[model samples]
Target: MAQSSSGTDGERRLDLIAMGRAGVDLYGEQVGGRLEDMGSFAKYIGGSPTNTAVGASRLGLDVGLLTRVGGDHFGRFIREELEREGVDTAGVRTDPDRLTALAILGIRDPDSFPLVFYRENCADMALCVDDIDPALIARTGALLVSGTHLSRPGVFQASMKAAELMKRQGGRVVFDIDYRPVLWGLAAKENGEDRFVASAAVTESLQRILPLCDLVVGTEEEIHILGGLSDTVSALRAIRERTAALLVCKRGANGCVAIPGAVPDDLDDAVVERGFPVEVFNVLGAGDAFMAGFLRGWLRDEPLEQCCAFANACGAIVVSRHGCAPAMASWEELQLFLDRQDWPHRLRESVELEHVHWATNRHRDYPELTVLAVDHRSQFDDLLAELGAGTPEQVAHFKRLALDAVHQVAAGDPRFGVLLDGRFGARALEAAADLPYWIGRPIEVPGSRPIRFEGAPDVETSLREWPLNHVVKCLVFYHPDDDQEMKARQDRQLLRLFDACRATRHEFLLEIIASKHGPVDSTTVARVIDHIYSLGIYPDWWKLEPADDAPTWDAVQAAILRYDPLCRGIVLLGLSAPREELLAAISAAAPFGLVRGFAVGRTIFHEVAAGWLTGVIDDAGAVAALAENLRVLSDAWRTARDARQAA
Candidate 1:
């Protein structure tokens, strides 16, 4: 098993340890526009070495990053982001004298992305040999060094020291010739450079460290500068003569070629080509992603061809997206992509590949959530009809009343989320989108005969029209003993919805209620849950009914963990029970760590909404009653949770 550097046993077994640049990248949100006219920017953790480390970590590798960042927010942001992605930050140092590096990037065209580097005496470039620990390098299986750092004296010395330690310890030294000419004072501006004026000084500096690397990777143009030859074949030979290291050439879209050191005089026979065709979006971080993928396979002692293929796939995926580090796919997503028959084919432009990438890599940090479910349609109609007021105006008024109640309960709390539907709560749902709270909107009609989806004719079209930030809350009444045809139909419907949610990057909340056809006990619920997982549909949240006992909750929790550990904890659903009964159920479920919180709608606001619709109570009265119910339940859940934690 691969051990992380920060393991408690002090066992220093890391898959890969990288040393070099780390910075923040500010990306322009406006596509097809120049950087000057862009209005908004999205911040991402940038820098080649940092991106590679993050990519490898996401691919299930235990990696560590060694660099320095300023004692500022950007530095802290970089550290937090890396840690969140499972990269070891034990070697990351803080320097108070300088600011962290910054890169301003703009998507000017499909092939051109304008970038400005602000690294004048930046903290990352100020790395020193003393900052690198030789013991740390010895513990890692491989040490990856970025080439741009070698252009500067301070970082160059540090890279050399790290390489020396890795070589001395019998570990592999992988050198990524990440050539950024502008960073080395060779180019006037920061942009893509295919070739630069190769000076003796540049060649001598690169040659000094080339022989020390066990493996060297660079583009055709990068190899030109390293070998002082413009012709790629001649350059490959020149670099081969200088060092016994294996050479890997990066050919964008065309794939890559690997030449081993033990090859005979014939270079063509020894060269192995591997790659997949993909529509290029931005080629900025493709190389870094390739390096990460290659290293993942390389460290595991996989075949050279397999490593090259993996590298090509990683590169292809990143180039089709917008950002670099954040766009890298997880191991599962990569496998899914590769398993398809369309190895080199591109999806349509309407399909945002970034959505799938983001959805797969999304990190779950919410250990506990308090959700207020107000997605009641049929129940609301019944209440309004009982009051002799079943008009559209009355329904809209009732929805507003519910929204006001939710707002009152969620005013001072940041952990509150609301589940609203489109039937009568469309306006409320729109208003909830503007609030600083987690919002969940329903996709299935409240109580269709066989549970029909709302909105467009198909689930995909409906999801495409949904706001990206809102979670797709799907309620299904499924029983373990339903007829084969009915079960199969619902199964196919859910599978389609899951695929749509994943493709469109919508967080899903699957609310499952056992149908009245069968006895709905904890065992039946667990059986239904198991059946859902067996179908391979994983949702972000599971809104389930409260279990009767600790063992029952444990069974459900075990099923969820067994199927998908990434599944967020379960939230209790109200079955239109009384407020006191719902509170009791929440208290019983709150002790289980897997039960995060509750999503009780009718119990909290059904009576209040009815009174407001009948004009028996004023708007303020309804709001007060609804708010009190929500607060009481929220307080009860929290108290039980805190007590369980304390005990």
Candidate 2:
């Protein structure tokens, strides 16, 4: 809200640099359960500065995180998560001596959240003077330092060095009073839930850096600890005396008060912005989210009132949801939330808002795909039966060979993928996870007309164990003209599966085989897709049979876009067609751009698997043959794509 002429340099790369902790958060999934009784936990990126970095990035700010994490998988996870959120990670250093910080949190009630910090000698705390990059501090337009980093002497010096460098460059310095007494050793190490435990040392340390800050944000308790006074107004006055920095006092449900000038004698006279009144589910990372939202506007020189409104709305949205960083809304979603005056008071229950969140926050892009579909269950069993000597182990090994073929032709390629099932290809699935290929797993029963999930009685429970990167794929044979009862049952099953994927944050791929129920015309597939979308089920991907003509592809694209313009596009399916015919279909679909690529299964794998099972080929021979077949198809798709682009 204040101008700094030195910060207006055109060469600065980032708008804000968040300097502090970077770590992982494991939140208990079971609500109303004690931390000791928790059975499962959901992993998310955490730490106050990390959350603020992600939040600011989501709201369209060019932000960078300046912190350290351990040289471990969890540390790599933090850096990758920040990068995915569009935050620059050039300043994210890896500390080899200590592990990354971890926080285990659980929600027992609306008012009670149990937290335990495992940050002793953590990597972030090991941030020393050498980690501070003077060039980075000079180039940033603003610097935000969380108070937790200032608790220990070593990191406190690191924080102060960055702040002083930013001050010397005339860049803005923001202070988020992220005080936790347990982290400061003022409370029992086990009591991380305690937000406030005053210490004269903590107060004195904060007063030392107050003069350098351009803006200071804290809850009432944090302000009290900073100003060394018990009264809110007196604390505000005392803090005002130390620095002319604008103070944003966060008042948890009521709203926040921004005192840009001197403290008013009466608390009611402060400039206040009202917060959205919503049902609070968990308030763990709401303050971090608030700071993120505030900076989204603050760094852009927006009005302080507008900045506070954005901050309050963001905090409100996260408190009504689940984990911290993942719960932050995208800029588009936040605007929609504010524009809709009659929105459902419960933000989580609004389908429109949830869809916006899902669509906007998805950072990965798949412009094209070439996937091998080896997830056919009953067909593999039938092949084994015809061989009369093969075991399930052989099928599993053959599946692995298929994966090897995929790797040979398209290793490290994001466009190449595999669609395999856990029934017979469990070993193959395990091996595929390490590669950079697009991995999809099927859950549909081989050929249940009304749709049934394999392996588990409750599909939702089974999905909890799936890796977040694996897309959930389901196949159904349905005709628009089917009997009403049968169609309704299939619709209900599809809805349930889609809901499960949404709940678990997995992408959903719906494969429709309309020809199985009746003869398919050019328009038949498009009609079935329209009917499904009419039922309010918008899947992330649509896998369908390729159309013979341009008009048919046009009809399908129109139907998909009419419902969800952001759909992940379609993938052409191969139903055991001849190689020549499949190539022709690829050439036809290539020009449309709506068809992403192809998932041709039996066409490429059937002969190789059959030869391997019947003793006509060894494992190496089968792998080579499968690789050759897939290579031909992949080359054909590329040629078609090139030809279309040239035309």
Candidate whose TM-score is highest? 2
lDDT, candidate 1, 1-647, per-residue tens: 12355556576568898889999998777878878899867688999999999889877789999999999999998998888788888789999999999998877776678888899999999999999887778668889998888998988899999899888889988888887778888777655333466766777788788878888999988888888888877888888887888899898877888888653454446666656666777777889999988887888888998888778888888887777888886887677667765543553242334434554587545777887788777777777678786576777766777777777988846578888877777888888866766788899976653668988888887887777778898889888888888888889888898888976668889988884567776677778889988887788889987665777788888888887766767899988887778878877888788888988887887777767776788878987898888889889988989988998
In model 2, the runs with Cα more than 4 Å from the true position are 1-12, 266-271, 387-389, 642-647
Clash pairs detected, candidate 1: none
lDDT digits (tens) for residues 139-222 of candidate 2: 688999999999889999999999999999999999998999998889997799998987899999888889999999999999
Q: Indicate the residue-level lDDT of 330 in model 2.
A: 89
Residue 33 lDDT in candidate 1: 80
The TM-score measured for candidate 1 stands at 0.68
